[model samples]
Target: MDAHRKQRQAQHPSLTITDMYNVLEKLRSGEALSAKEQKTHEQGLVSILLQLHTELDAAVAAAYGWPANLPEEEILERLVALNKERAAEEARGLVRWLRPEYQNPQGTQQTEIGLSTKTKVAKATAKETLAWPKTLSEQAQAVQRALQLHERPATAEDLLYQFKPVAKPQQGQRLQQIDSLLQTLHGLGLLRKTELEQYVK
Candidate 1:
């Protein structure tokens, strides 16, 4: 039993928060790990896995009104499975960041393409100006279509660009109308101002 304990201790090295942070920093910076760094990362990974397994066992035991008696090998196996799942979830979040519809921040009211960074004024305001619709049905349908086409927070300019074949109001009137719609949607929390002034869903 003493020999078995020693073997297990040798396999699972202790890790500190500093070690974990170092591994994360290296990963974020896209740096190639040295042999020592690689070993540290492996140790840190194993440490987290073991800690999670122990926590889970304790939680499960408490929930069932029993004391935990989880074995080390079982904890190690569960940790491996959980780590894979965590990696997959992170990859999915990265994919979302790359998608055009979600790539931009949702709350920006306008794009500040050439604005000086020193300017204190916001690129756009969230002020509401949309005129109430004469008929709820028409308004609802328009909103639904806009959402389907990924035109959420769609500016009048964007609408005009998208549906060029459709006749539209004069530029002044069109701008006013879009502002009104944007106000209504913003109030409903369907759209928000993204970075600078760009609006998105």
Candidate 2:
């Protein structure tokens, strides 16, 4: 604050508290000063006002028993402890952030679930998920299309092999779904399964 006030004094050599009050009174009474002097005068007033507000905020926080500063380690430890306690309370359906009147009647457990930073949305419903098809029939059609494009029967593992330029990537994790769809297609007489090989009809 002192440095700022000194800087302002250097900028406006004749600036003073008396000068500021007189200029403010003149402004209030609809009198105008040169634009450059008015800017300098306002800067001086604003610098003092900034310091005054800063000191007032510190005083108010002190009056309420708030510390001005805390060690970085202490802050981190407090945040971790707070998060742990909040998690425990939330698990017991004691959510405190939401209003009592506005709390979900079905349950807060579901509302609070999947809120952790590490939590995912089950991959399929991820926010960045594309419109890559997922229905039983759609997945079966995908397998059939892959087979017909190859123009030959393909083994279960071969069908699982992803062709490039395909909208959806390899169904590596979803081999079970792919297998199920193939079985359903075979059951519906849309596909022919001879040994481990599947043929599109």
Candidate 3:
């Protein structure tokens, strides 16, 4: 039983409310999650469901003053309702964080960076053939650093800056190299440039 518990723990580490919210947010926005990220997200969802199931089961048992066992359908129905309530609560919280003050489209409002500009950049960046110059390990390191910053649609400079010794100087001759990398990412549709240069998710 201890071994079983350990195995379960390894497979299903507990997730916090924020972890579930992040997973849901990524899914809602149609963001692509790598296999590892997807696995973590699924584990988090399962953990939330299991917790809800236990709570509902206890509540029903207490209410009826009955045994631990309940009909599967009844349990499921209650769980569904609980999930809906949780979702609503989460949405309200998200709205508070996503209020208009923080809500800005990628450079769309600027006359200089209007639809045409976006389209041009997006088209250039949306090429499926373009690949990152970094190795898998290096790319993962860059992505990890980018995740630490509050910025969304992190600029090419921002990503390269995170690389430090691995990346060239920020200005002069290195500017063209940085631009080339960003353009490559944009062509590959990996990064979306938004208004105010914010990159989310």
Prediction 2 global C-alpha lDDT: 0.51
Judging by TM-score against the true structure, name the best candidate: 2
The local distance difference test score of each candidate is 0.45, 0.51, 0.44
Prediction-by-prediction clash tally: 12, 0, 16
Q: TM-score each candidate.
A: 0.27, 0.29, 0.24
lDDT of 1 by residue, 76-152 (tens): 67557756755676577522222234554573333321112332122322332223234433343243234335435
Where does model 2 exceed 4 Å of error? 1-132, 163-172
TM-score, ranked from best to worst: 2, 1, 3
User: Over the stretch 1-201, how does candidate 2's per-residue lDDT look in tens digits?
Assistant: 456667767887877756655565566556777775477568687446444444443332222223435455865675587689778976986664332223545544323222343321222211221233544333444565565545567665665554332425545555655565565555544456665465543
RMSD of 1: 23.2
- The CA lDDT at 194 in model 2 is 62
Off by over 4 Å in 1: 1-137, 150-154, 164-169
Best by lDDT: 2
